[model samples]
Target: MLHSRFCCQWGNTLSSTLLRFPLADHKKVFAIALPMILSNIAAPMLGLVDTAIIGHLPDAIYLSAVAIGAMVVSFIFLLAVFLRMATTGYIAQSFGANDRAAQRQHFNHGLLLAVLLGSAIGLGSPWIIDFAMWIVQPDTQLIPLASDYIGIRLWSAPAALITLITLGVLLGRQQSGRAMWLAIITNGVNVVMDVILILGLGMNVKGAAWASFSADYVTAAVGLYWCARALNWSPTSIHIKFNALRQYASVNGNIFIRSLVLQLCMATMTGYAARYGSTVVAVNAVLMQFLMLISLGLDGIAYAVEALTGAAKGQRNPHKVAYWCRLTLLWSCIFAIAYTLLFWLFGPAIIGLITDIPEVITTAAQYLPWIVLLPLIGHWSYWFDGVFIGLSLSKGMRNTMILAAAFGFLPLWWLGLPLQNHGLWMALSGFLLMRGVFQALWLRLRWRQII
Candidate 1:
């Protein structure tokens, strides 16, 4: 559905206002972005809580084990993130076109796909878990603890995927406030569980895993309620057409490839970081949290771009689409600059809050400069991701990411082996910057055609 539209210069019916380039309304951006920011913060806030709890433990191995273990589960969940992203795009367009039926159809398709993929991941967890652990090859002391954490968390695969779809619908409909609440509630539950299981009961790594598992299921149930109420939809009305399913799958398949590369980059980063030992990997883990904060916080702007740009595209209003693309990029830059200042100012203190280990703290502080550089360097790609997702330009995303990872990050990392961790940071920064550069080139070259 999307590949054709983007490639063929979309021929959908245009609203009469298509020619009018009205002034950009900043309110529309905030209306969608603000709630998402809070919602986006919740997960990282959970990570911070998890890290803080695990970091304070007597041994660095406990912190290291949980970090590696959570990475494994995050890789799995990240792979399936398309469920939310594709649903949001499709639903946003439907909402814009005032097509209730299309919205419902997309929602149903996302639900069906979620169940199948979730079930497959659950059944296949044993092998995936083994493979992930094998790649990282953590310290022997950390392996058992990590496996226990991963093993417990993997059980929530189905609920986790379903949660993606429910949240997808909320965002697609521009119901970001609802999405925010859903994220807050979900992470709040995880936070509480972490406190009880890790601090109170002294379960440590397993406790963090269980907290995540329980929170996911709760989110799935609650998210469905929100989506159903908003859409006035129910299970009994679930009707999926073969054509619709095919389109959904096609749109998401490209996303899957892109996501696979993303997970690969992350897994490789963690695996290599593990080679340096506990303190280094723990440092990497903490730094990754800062990265997540940047990405997710910037996601507020990106999500807004996806919904509004998608809606504008659906209305066949070239002027509005252009307006959105420009202003959202402006907002993204502002946000990125803000993060750059925040990290530079308080990064060490934040790292201090996470873990009390002097070695890990010092090692992590050494990398704060890279974290400071990231928001600005990598934010363009994040902003463009929203544009691509909204426009259903997944193939472009897939190609750019593959190119960035294969030609940019991998080669640079290989060439910089002498520099060690510094090399890894350079490669990552290069990878992110390359992605944005490629996408920007594509969009710039195709501006007239796509619009």
Candidate 2:
């Protein structure tokens, strides 16, 4: 009887302990992670919807044009994604330190940078569009349609950058729910506009662009309001210092380079896929959405890690940093496995459901296996990228990405060109593998020091 009583007491004590730490940690992570997951999922839903809608259009060119156009836009915006990354690190650090002043400074700096960069991108859209067109070698049937799509979508640069900065600040502040709210509202707006203009008004690809622009601008406004409310940062409190800007610029510059390399790799893949032909491009584009679904969903977890790691780093708490890394990696692997199985089992049905093109469906099914395998390679790099960003190890990420993209992935592509379209898939698969291995090796070595 005494022993039984002791066991009951121990069980109660263990349950209470879990209520305090590990269980609480799980709750905290999911509170932040769930909204981010939803937002991340919603952000790409527009593209999938677009591809689906365009697939049923008169010919495959509409589908191909949207695919190529979207990639061009993504590459352009990715060049500035550092705004979001830099903001994430700085804000996370500030939150950790409990320094509202510093956090406000980071937001201001990121906002200013976004404005300047957005203006530059907006102004150069024509030239940039032309350059993208040149590089992709858009055929006559698709060029005008693709050009129109780009022309309309370019207007969103300012709003998109601002939105990105807003998201960074929110995520850094652990207000991912607000971020998720913004993404949902924005995507909802985009979908309404997409349907209205595409089906109701018959604007074709231009309708899609207009929808994106309207949604982004509206969301940017919402983001600004949320930023003001959440940060309690106002014009009266805004302080800009040259030293702060310089420090931010330095970190941001390195991140920009790292992100640029990443985007270039994506652009190369899309460009080469375009070279394969419109049918292939359409199939690849649809399949690419599924990839984004997996990657971005995982990225929400990565962002959680980024925010937590930055917080821990700011507090000089090495154990916390290490804890976050382990926790994030474990969760990421679980999600990766789940997504892999999801794609493997239902990929064909999903592809067919999204489009009416039989050839596109067949081609995408053939490539689905690689997609299934990518999360294992791609998920970890994303997690590490977040962790490294939190530590402000931008140069490390930049160097590794450069090496991986240049020496690791590109060479494999060059060698595999003889395999035709299959070669491209092989190259992409090789790229993800190289990134996973390279980043994993780097993290294993540097984890002790960074944490």
Candidate 3:
């Protein structure tokens, strides 16, 4: 009876605390987050749609080729993702400072940088593809198929990077709805083209690549239209300062390293899975979809945090930063718990929808528990990542990821090798958990400087 009374008291306290949360802030967060959630999900949907289409082909080689080809492109793109991250933080802070001129300048600079980098990647595709193929050493049968896919997709590099800058600008300005629309149109077009070219026209992997290529340019056009309207573009208004460019490059350089390491971790995961045989590789691929879903959903909230916290920093308001941090953390935890429950209850049904092979299903189930726990274990790192990006603390972010990869993930994998696939999942979980812990500790130690 005494324990029951204590529980009731605890529940009441929790309810009271929640009741005191600012409704306006909650609404603002969801306003930004909901659209972003949809937008982010559309990104992975492109890959999913591709996988679904290719997987239905007569040979599994098609699926493997598409998978490997997509991985190579994703890794390269992610390395340049600093275009989005840096642009968002810079623009957000500039917005908060009410510096319209600075904002316009940054916008122009971002686009210029995007164009230069994207063109470089496109022009140098041969070397990039060669490097990736050497690293992965795909099955002989898949080399030509994968190469064709990569060859066609590389042309979209410039458009893709430009869209990234445009979306970053809108998101940093808190115009998430517009940014969301851009993503929707792009992915939606890609889906339609994928169905038409691959399935309708029977163009195979090359068709899928062409669909993505076309959708990218279309998305770039839309993004350019919206961005021009927002900025009311004028040639006279554009100016570039050498100092500003240097500063931008410095921040992006750190982010570049951070992203490089993060992608390396993912590539390592996929590479290791491939060694376990075709069945295990297929199982890991399906399981990765679950992780991607969680990331896209959680990243919505993280994006909002990035905008709000960056603005707070520009305003020099520690209190506002702290408030946003608390609220976002609460929401993240709730989502993490919900994801855990959903996966635990419906893991089988979800797996069934992804693949029909009975053996794959059975093998996946043996490892389902790890995926179920992923959201809970890794949610904090996602949250911390937003905070660091918002504040432009890229060095700390880079350090923590390096530490997590080297100290946490590598050692754990070595120790758990006897467990095979289970060991990989365990190492991944440890890597994520350590990333959050180390980042949080770093933030705590440097809180004063950031605020």
Instruction: Give the CA lDDT, 0 to 100, for residue 382 in model 1.
Output: 92
- In candidate 3, which residue ranges exceed 4 Å CA deviation? 1-14, 43-67, 139-141, 194-205
Off by over 4 Å in 1: 1-24, 46-68, 136-152, 191-211, 274-283, 343-369
lDDT of 3 by residue, 1-451 (tens): 9999999998898677666678888888888899999878776667577678878988888788878888788777768888888888888888777777777888888888888988998899889889989988988899999999898888799999988888888888889999999888887888899889989999888988898899899998998888777777565666789799888878888988888888777777778888889999999999998987798779999998888888888788899889888988888997899899999999999999999999999999999999999999999999998888888888898899999999888998888788989988999999999999999999999999878
Assess every candidate by TM-score.
0.83, 0.83, 0.91
User: In model 3, which residue pairs have backbone atoms overlapping below 3 Å?
Assistant: none
Q: After superposition, how far is residue 355 of candidate 2 from its true place, in Å?
A: 5.2
- Model 2: per-residue lDDT, tens digit, 89-204? 88888889898888888888888888888888878888988999898897888888998888878878889999989988888888989989988888788888978988889888
**lDDT of each prediction vs. the true structure?**
0.86, 0.82, 0.87
Give me the displacement of residue 206 in model 1, in angstroms. Answer: 6.6
Clashing pairs in 1: none
- For 16-46, candidate 1 gives per-residue lDDT tens digits of 2332323346777888998988767676667
TM accuracy, model 1: 0.83
The candidate scoring highest on lDDT is 3
Model 2 Cα displacement at 451 (Å)? 4.0
Candidate 1, lDDT over the whole model: 0.86
TM-score of 3: 0.91
Give candidate 2's root-mean-square deviation (CA, Å): 5.8
**Superior candidate under TM-score, 2 versus 3:** 3
